[model samples]
Every structure is written in C-alpha cells, then in structure tokens.
Target: MIDLFHCFGAKPAHRVDTSLAAEMLRASGCRHLAVNTHTIDQVTAGDDLPVGYDTATLGSVMALVGEELALSPVLNINHPTSAAEAVKRTRQAAQLTGIRVIKLEVLDPGFKLSVNAEVVEAARELTADGFEVWPLITPDARTFAQCVELGSTMVRVMGSPIGARRGIEPQHLEPMGEMLVDSPVPVMLDGGIGSTADVEQAFALGFQSVLVNSCLFADGTDPVTALAGFRATVDRVASGTPAAH
Candidate 1:
C-alpha cells in the first residue's frame, strides 16, 4: 500500500495539540507520523540537546499512536559540519528511538550547494549498521542517481524548500516526475503540500508516498477532515479513478 506520512510535532510552531491530531490520524486511517527532532539552527550551532530536541513533547504522542501506525523520527542533517557527524547523529537517533526507518533531512535553506555526496555516504554507513535510510533530497537527476547507487531504501524529494507553504512549483513537476519514474527506490514527495489538490498531483506524478505538514497545521484546517480527504484521494488514484476536485 502507498504510505501517507503525516508530519506531526515537527516544529514548535506546529506542535498544537498532537494528542488530538494523533486521534484524528488514527480515525482517518493515516498510518505514519514523522516527528522532527531538531531545527537546522540547533544542528548547525552544535547544540547538545535531548533526543527529540525541543520536540520532546512528542514522546507521549508517539507512544499514543502505538504499533498500528509506524513512526519515523526526522533527523535534520542539513548543517552537520562533516559527514561523520551526520552519520553519528543518524545512528544515535535510530538507536535511541528504536525505529527501523530513519528519515534524513539533508537539504535546507542555509546551504546553497548540493550535499548529495555527503548524504549518500551517510546513507551508505547507516545501511551497513542495519538501519533503513530515507534520504530527503532535492529533485535532481544526479542526486537521485547517487542515492539509488548507494542502495537507499527510499528517497524523499521536497516540492519546495522545507517549511515553505508554497506547495509544488509547476516548473518542478516535469523533472520531478521524470526522476520519480527512473528512480530505483521508491520516491516520496515532501514539504510544501498545501491542499488535497497538491496531494493528488503528487500521486499523479508517480510518487509512491507523500510527507505532509504545513497544510495539516494551517490556521483553519480541520486535521480530521484533511487527513480523511488525503486518504480518500490516495485511494482513488491508486484504483485508477480520477481524483475528486
């Protein structure tokens, strides 16, 4: 089945009542939640905070979600000074959380250049340590090729810069779609998904999964209804029916 990851408790600003969100997710048949550990600043500053960083409140939420739905802790490696640091942080987080899949956030606003090589190396090391690695990357052929070459389990391509509410840009879809078709590993669309239409478009573009956040926690968005809407849209697309407007 195509997995839909609802990113809850990813940022301090979006932490609004995760218990209610968790309940809603369960009821809506959403089976995955990706929790954000630390912000890009904390990682770049080399802060030694606790496991979940400022998002420690999510610990109870994760437990509340239980075994039916899988939980993935998103470890942001966007600002690691070195590749070794990135691998160390990923390994530590996986071991601490006991989660089999570790989502690595390598792309961020601070960095202007591509860090595909560093991220690929980290994924390689983590795989050797017996952990499934999901490297979050930009939609580029070279980056996708490297991740596939390193045997990544799944690759997450952002629709836009992380945390931006601008959804997927029209210009990005063609290249993103091409890469998705050619990628050996499953490609998940992440970031900037603002509505059910965006979700429909991602699935239409051939992404096997989607990681969403901003839209769910938006000012007036009803989490329960939104989750259900996305689930229904995915189901329809998977069955080869046209998505409902």
Candidate 2:
C-alpha cells in the first residue's frame, strides 16, 4: 500500500494549526507528518516566530501527536549562502530538535549547478552525522542520480513549483516518474498536490508516498473532511479501484 506523509505544518502561508492537523491526520489513520521548519528562509529573513513555531516546538508537537505517527520535520536550507552554512544549519537544527530525517531544499529559484556540489557535500556531512538526508530537488533524472550519489536517504520531487496551487504539472509527471523508477533511493512526491485526483495520479505514476500541504488547509475546505477524503482516495487507489479519467 502507498504510504501517505502529510505536511502537517508549513510556512506561514501554507500553515495550519499543527495540533489540529496532527489530530486529523491521526484520526484519518495517516502515519507520517513532515513538519516544515523552513530554517534558511526564516533565519535569513530574521523573522521571529512564536515559541511554538520553532524547531524545538516541532519536536514537542510531534511528541504530542503520539508515538504511532512518524514525524519527520523538513529542514529546508534553500537560502544558505554557502555549503558550510548549509551543513552548519542542518546540524544545528537536528541537534536542537532531535529530528532524524532532514529534508534539504536544493531547488530554489536561483538554483545553480555550482551549488549542487555544495548540496552534495552537505548531504554527505549530514549522513556521516547519522541524519537521514532527504533532498528536495527538481525532478530531473540527473539531479536524482546526483542526490543518490551524494548519500541522500531519499529524494523528494516537486510535483510542480513549490507553493503553486495549480496542481501537478502533467507534462513533468511521467518523466519524473521514469526517473524515480530508476532511482537507487525511495522517491516521494511533494508540493502542488490539491485533491484525491492528484493523489490518484501520483500513485498511478508510481510514487509510493506523497507530501501534501496547501490542499489540506485550503480556504473553503474543512481540514478534517479534506484529510478523510484524501485517506479514502489513497485506500481506493491502493485497493486497485480505477481512477476516473
């Protein structure tokens, strides 16, 4: 069966009440929550969040969410000025929060090939330090190979541009799925997932798991109802029910 990893908390724009999201996810029988720390952006912008919004708070919230649900907080280092800074911040966040799986963002708008080396190095360092490194990169086959070569525990492919509510970009899905099929590490679909149709499409495309954020907290949808619908869709697809064309 395909596992569902819900993005329980996210940046302020996609943020939901962490506790409430967790409760709904648990009730829906969801087993994973990828909380977003957004460290690079927050630290670079010098933004001060409430106590409960901090990395440590994420751990506390996850603990409160109960032991059954595995919580992996996404430690996005999208804005790191240098490779060393990325490694440093990753280590610091892991140390502070005790989160084992660290999700690195290497697909910033300003992404350059030059930074790939740096990101690879940071992944190596994090892995050496006993952290499970999951780099969020563009869905390019070469990039996916590079991440595996760099010791990434898993690869997260963006279904569309991050925070774009337009849903999965159809043209990109097949190619990305092909790349994922050949990846040495597990590949997860992240971002731009807006409905059960999106989830159905993701599974059909061979993604074993998905990370959804905005869809759950979208305006006009009741969060609990939305989650339950997603759970049902996952079940239907897993059970071999045909997706509507």
Estimated TM-score per prediction?
0.78, 0.77
Tens-digit lDDT track of model 2 for 34-88: 4444443354221221212333344455557646566444555544645677778
- lDDT (0 to 1) per candidate: 0.64, 0.63
Cα error of candidate 2 at position 166, Å: 2.8
How much is the lDDT of residue 54 in candidate 1?
36
Which model scores highest in lDDT?
A: 1
Tell me the tens digit of each residue's lDDT in model 1 across 9-106.
Answer: 33456544545656666755655445443442243322222222233333655556645567444444444544577777766555455556667755
Q: Give the TM-score of candidate 1.
A: 0.78
Q: Pick the candidate with the highest TM-score.
A: 1
Model 2 residue runs over 4 Å out of place are 13-15, 38-56, 68-84, 107-121, 243-245
Candidate 1 lDDT at 95 equals 49
RMSD of every candidate to native, in Å, equals 4.6, 4.7
